[model samples]
Target: MADEVRQHMLECEARTWLRNGYNTPERIQELTLMIANRRGQVSAERLIEEMRRQWRRRSEWLN
Candidate 1:
């Protein structure tokens, strides 16, 4: 199903962030909750966009 694919992609991306040490515990926790609450209820594009926004904010903070 499309939702399955989206969830898979989201998990993959989260793993990448974890592997790269780009995610903080708090951020990871937040994302986990967001994904849990939104999966099936929201589109993959929207979820990824939210993650991207978080990534950008973190990047800005780091810079």
Candidate 2:
């Protein structure tokens, strides 16, 4: 059940990324490495905070 939900969520997120023209496998790999490398040195909260910051800036520019 959880796995099914996870798969659906991944699909939906991938669709969103594709629509935004940022659905490259290389970008995904870089993101994976960035998260993994920071696991011991940084927290998930901090990483999400940065993502939110960037997304907000992009949204502002788009609008």
Work out the TM-score per prediction: 0.38, 0.39
lDDT tens readout by residue for model 1, 20-60:
56466676566656666767434434555556665655644
Tens digits of per-residue lDDT, candidate 2, 10-61, equal 5444445434654355764565466658673344334444444445555544
**Clashing residue pairs for model 2:** none
Give stretches of model 2 more than 4 Å off.
Answer: 23-63
Q: Give RMSD (Å) of candidate 1 vs. truth.
A: 9.8
Error (Å) of candidate 1 at residue 14 is 0.3
> Lowest summed-lDDT stretch of 10 residues in model 1?
40-49
Give candidate 1 misplaced runs (Cα > 4 Å).
25-63
lDDT (Cα) of model 2: 0.50
Q: What is the lDDT of candidate 1?
A: 0.59
TM-score (C-alpha, index-matched) for candidate 1: 0.38
